[model samples]
Target: MIALDIENVTKSFGGVRALTGVTLSLNEGERLVLLGPNGAGKTTLFHSISGNILASSGRISLFGDDITQLPPDARARLGLARTFQITNLFAQLTVLENILLAVCGAQKLTFKFVRPLDRYDDIQKRARALLEEWNLVDAADRLVRNLSYGEQRQVEVVMALSGEPRILLLDEPTAGLSPAETLRVMEMVRKLPRDMTIVMIEHDMDVAFEIADRIAVMHQGRVIAEGDEAAIRGNQQVSDIYLGVE
Candidate 1:
């Protein structure tokens, strides 16, 4: 089944266009990596899909349902989750508290002012399960601000998973990590359920090739090449853009 369909999407900022007629599709449970030089419109496409920014022209569908007009929250409710290139978390909150808040938000329990959050057994259960399942119990009580950068990235991924999303968009999940930290994240991603579809933007060539079932190379607001590892590896345009090969 097609999990996401982005057809003829475009995004413009005043006189400049960030994405131009970008079209891509992902199958259910497939892993797609977006490869590009800086300013290739990778993040812009992500924003469009996640509803952070609306496309100037085109159609986006999630599971055959047109979601081009939906807001971010509405899309979240429909099983879409994403992580930013930067860490998005409550620095002062402990890991457990952060997970609790994410669970509450995902379940839309933030408006329940009459009931204390702790009183919600279901929410607490879900948070605890997430911590245990992700092997984050050891740092459950530590402040996010106190955790290492790599650990914080892992926490962000766990938070994204709290909603049980069918499709996940990750923007540079291992951007600033050390080699060891990168390996840890790669292992974590490898352990994800095979049923979850993932689309990621990665600058690390090794990481991109290792995790991607297919790759799409973007350059100057367009997808210039796409295929499996071998096909992408041999594409002259991709080589010219990234490796300066003739």
Candidate 2:
């Protein structure tokens, strides 16, 4: 079944066309990786899909519901989650506290200022479980600012997952990392339940090919080619535009 769809999507910023007439669909539980060189408009499409930015024109739907005009938080509440290219975390907050906040937000309890901390014991337990699930228990008490760049990225991912989203859009998930750190993140992604649909913008070919069941290649604000990994690898246009193999 199709879990997400983007139809006739277009976005422009002033005179620059970030995306032009892009369309794509993802099956439930499919792992799709968006690939492109710089200026390919991969991030723009991600923003449109995740509702971080409005599409200049098009329709976006999740599991058969139109959400093109929804805000980020509303889309998030609709079982869509995303992670930015940069780490978005509470730097001054401890890992556990940050996780608790995510859990609270997921449960819509963050606005209940009158509620006592004791009232959120279940959320606290779930937060600890997430920390343990990601092997972050050792650093749970440490401030996010004290964590390494790779660790911060890992935490950012877990935070996104805290909501148990049915569809997750990740932007440059392995963007800045040592080879080892990249591998670690890939392993984590690989172990996730297959019931969750994943769409990620990735520059790291190894990680992309390793995790993506389908690959979509973009160039100059358009998707140039999309297919299975083998098809993408042999497509001359993709190799020419992205790999620069003349």
Which candidate number maximizes TM-score?
1
lDDT of candidates 1 onward, in order: 0.92, 0.88
After superposition, the stretches of candidate 2 with alpha carbons farther than 4 Å from their true spots are 109-119
lDDT of 1 by residue, 65-84 (tens): 89998899888887899999
Shift of residue 222 alpha carbon in model 1, Å: 0.4
- Tell me the tens digit of each residue's lDDT in model 2 across 134-222: 99999999999999888888898899998889998889877878988888888888888899999999997778888999999899899
What is candidate 1's CA lDDT for residue 224? Answer: 91
Question: How close to the true structure is residue 142 of candidate 1, measured as C-alpha lDDT?
Answer: 100
Find the 10 residues in a row with the least total lDDT in model 1. Answer: 109-118
> Any runs in candidate 1 off by more than 4 Å, and if so which?
109-119, 244-246
| Clashing residue pairs, backbone N/CA/C < 3 A, model 1 | none
Model 2: weakest 10-residue lDDT segment is 109-118
